[model samples]
Target: MSKLFDLGLMVRTYRDPLAWLTLFVDLLPIIAIVFFGWKAIPLVALYWLENLVIGAWTLMRMLGTIAGNILNLPIMLFLGPFFCVHYGMFCFGHGIFLQAMSGNDQGGAFGGGPVALVEWALGTAPHMIWFVAAIAAVNGVFYLVDFLILGGYRKTQPIAEMFSPYGRIVTLHVAIILGAGLMMAFGQPLLGVLLLLFLRVVFGMALNMMRRLKLDGGLPKTLDPFADMQVETG
Candidate 1:
């Protein structure tokens, strides 16, 4: 609990420019919440969309590590499709839940699948295409810089890449879903929207710090299942 609102953690985490880029991406939803008059549905939809973005980048990270080992090819071939189908349905089902909560289960939009969910989500949030694109761009930058150029893949395995996102996603969304529920219960007030934004940014900071600690081999045992893994020094 004390760790959740750790401002010092955020200060250290955002010292990296890439972290600032992540913050920028995370903050984009605020524009709709403020100026464009978005409510919980759009905000949560944007986050659900961002999860797909995260899955896309995670898949790339898995692909990036294949050259590091021969065994990884089979693993990648198996898990790549597995992650796509599983994560797609995971997000799709979550989208359907959000639609049901928002009082919409129309056959055309939420009826189809992930693509339809994406379209429905973007339509719900006015000018959300740009926000979603911003998130994808930040993810692309991180992949190019941290995963590729910084040789994150050199020290990483497909399995680690596969499971790392779940921890982050689950940690962040529990609070998000709770906040959304409260916001919806209260008639979607502006204060609720802003609190949701703050909650996401704070959770992002926490997860990013944990990620850095994992990379540098500084994460405590409680937080470091991959503690046996060493840091990438090259």
Candidate 2:
């Protein structure tokens, strides 16, 4: 463990092109799969593995104290499956819902039917709760790590700061939910989803522009890089 700690410190101290390249390459096959479909799973898995390796390396570098990693290991283990199922349903159900809303007759595509709606609600419920929890957990770990490494700021302050992003994220999530509910109430959930998607896309682009300018923190400051990447590539 001590040896691994030394390695991670080394990586963090000296930025490596190979590490960044690995990240990019690891992400590339996943993109290709999105375009090409299941045929790319093998390559996708390969890339994912490489990405994990890079993540470990990067984590080691950023976190000198094993305490951060020790804490992150379990939460991340759970977060992996949590995000997979929640996001999988989020993607699949929301897609179907939007399609149905568009008058495509995609039954329960976006929770169109009562049964589908129930399933969609169930799938997203945990994420609604755990997303906040995971953010808190991660922030706690980072707080400890940062405190141990740099010895700056009060211990609790970092944890609070880390969770600050979630407050905004929760707000956006609520807006999306409210918009979706209004759509369902007005008997146009599909239209609501489509509009929501459109709003998300536009709002996302605007946020990206803000980030590029380092002008974050306002009405629409929360930016999910994953979401941005998806929109750009998607």
User: Which candidate ranks first by TM-score, i.e. highest?
Assistant: 1
Off by over 4 Å in 2: 1-70, 106-201, 213-234
Tens-digit lDDT track for model 1 on 156-188?
788767765665456446756777666768875
In order, what is each prediction's RMSD in angstroms?
A: 4.7, 15.1
lDDT of 2 by residue, 1-234 (tens): 122234443354225332333234323433333454322112212222222222332233223223434664465455445544553444344434433433433455333543454343334322222322332344344334434544423222212222223223333444456666766688764454444444434433333333332212221221222223233433
Q: How good is model 2 by TM-score?
A: 0.28
lDDT of 1 at 186: 84
Poorest 10 consecutive residues of model 2 by lDDT? 213-222
Best candidate according to lDDT = 1
How much lDDT does each candidate structure score?
0.71, 0.36
Q: How good is model 1 by TM-score?
A: 0.83
- Clash pairs (backbone) in predicted model 2: 8-60, 8-61, 12-61, 96-109, 96-110, 97-109, 97-110, 101-190
Candidate 1 lDDT score relative to the true structure:
0.71
